[model samples]
Target: MPDNRERDRKDHYLPRGFLKGFIDPANKDLAKPLWHFDLETTAWSRESPGSIGWERGMYDYHPGTNVLEHPDEVFERFEREFPLVREYLLRRNFKGWVKQHKHFLLEFAQMMRARSPLFLQQQTAQNENTRIMTVTSVGPGNQVGVDTTVPYPPPARFIRNRTITAMREEIKKGPDWMENFHWCLRYTRSVADPFVTGTQPIVVEGRYPNSNDAPVLEDALNDHNTIIWFPLCWQACLVGAVDRFDEGTAEAPPSLISHVRGMFRRPSAGYVISPIKIESF
Candidate 1:
């Protein structure tokens, strides 16, 4: 085994710079706190960006004594360019995306899907839920025969091994949205109903014909009706849908924010993040 000593222990799924967008505008303090509703405790608390959203050694895979494959650096690089994307988003300058900016934004979206606790939970659950069966029969000539069927869900060790090396491959291929959909940036002007996010920052739902249903993850992917919402900060969100990709600034319709807020209460995530204390939720 490779030496695992002296490694970076804090694996922050939600990087601080990305979460910084949700800081309340009224509080201009450098050490501003974010309000979070703990799903596990069923209580609210305040925390800094660096203190929350991390698990110990989630991504510390070692193949050599001194070498480390850090998504850490790539995450920081993506966040460094985030402000520019946010600037263009808030300004509704959708055309401002040069090749590099577009690349960063799309890849960040893919990372948001891959580099979260929710992703791990989903992949692990899919594997563990896999079922196998065995059948036994008696031969006419007093010989016994048996058959076994193994399903496609990979073993847990295989999953972990792939996760360590797959980040770059996934980044290179990018997300389905990058290839197929146009994008939208949504800005909510109301302070009372600012956008809220979660540990699993990327949330998805179906629309129109299937609005009442949540989209299935795979197997005939419901991408055509799926709508995704990613909270960029307290004021803005990035949205993508099959039908429309235009950006806009508007107050979320009366029932909309409440519905979206409910969607962020993912079972896998321990908490929900907001810019300010929200008693109503």
Candidate 2:
């Protein structure tokens, strides 16, 4: 059998199995008619979960060996437990949930943030610094001296490794801080305008745009003022608000869908994923 590193050459940041839930319910074809909209290009296309939202060896820490790092091992576990979350979303159950369940849900949301390309770029910029070296050469006697300077950028691998290390640390702490927040499972009454997700799926409402660093995210998670929205599937969305209570199984109004659809444009996401074809989100 192939080892973990070789199991998936194309690693999906957003779990492939999880995206399958967004497929159109009416489409009985095996093609899995999932709609993809490009926010930048204003173009749309049909796709399957396995064909999109993946990169070549994004999680392969080691290429020539069987060694797999924290991301692969950790993410695999989350995807495995996705079915349980799916069941929960399907039944719309709001009871019997323990702290661990809530914890994993929080961690999974953080992982989605960390795994995003934009987030990775932000983390890389935060971790890497340029090195400048200056050399002064003295000429014979009182001759003029020349100053030579060279700049060396940090290696891509070095920056990525450091970012990954920090990502591991942050992913662990994010969920813990936000565990006490009121979580609501909101569902759409119609599949016509199901919930939409994207490359940067987790939206931190009312927070500064592109301020998704660990410190900022942790602050948002801990702060009762910030609201977080996570699209679980076409029909369901997971919401976090510290002040709101008595939020049980409730119908997600069309106005709410319009609100989320409006959000996909801000900060400019790479892709907008949904069950129905959205002409212009």
- Best candidate per TM-score, number? 2
| Residue range 163-260, candidate 1, lDDT tens digits | 65465445556665454655666566776788888878877776443332322344223467777777777776667666654334344564777667
Q: Return the TM-score for each candidate structure.
A: 0.73, 0.78
Give each model's whole-structure lDDT.
0.66, 0.70
Model 2 alpha-carbon drift over 4 Å, by segment: 1-8, 62-70, 92-100, 130-154, 212-225
The candidate that wins on lDDT is 2
Write candidate 2's Cα lDDT for 1-281 as tens digits. Answer: 22344534787877887787787778637585888888788788888888888887665443233333567666677788876777774774444443436667777887777777667667778767745334465577966543434566656666666676666666656676567778877777677888888877887775555444344565565566687788877777888887775755577888887888777656554888888887656
> Which portions of model 1 miss their true places by more than 4 Å?
1-5, 30-32, 62-69, 91-103, 124-159, 207-220, 245-251, 266-269
lDDT of 2: 0.70
Clashing pairs in 2: none
Q: What TM-score quantifies how close candidate 1 is to the native fold?
A: 0.73
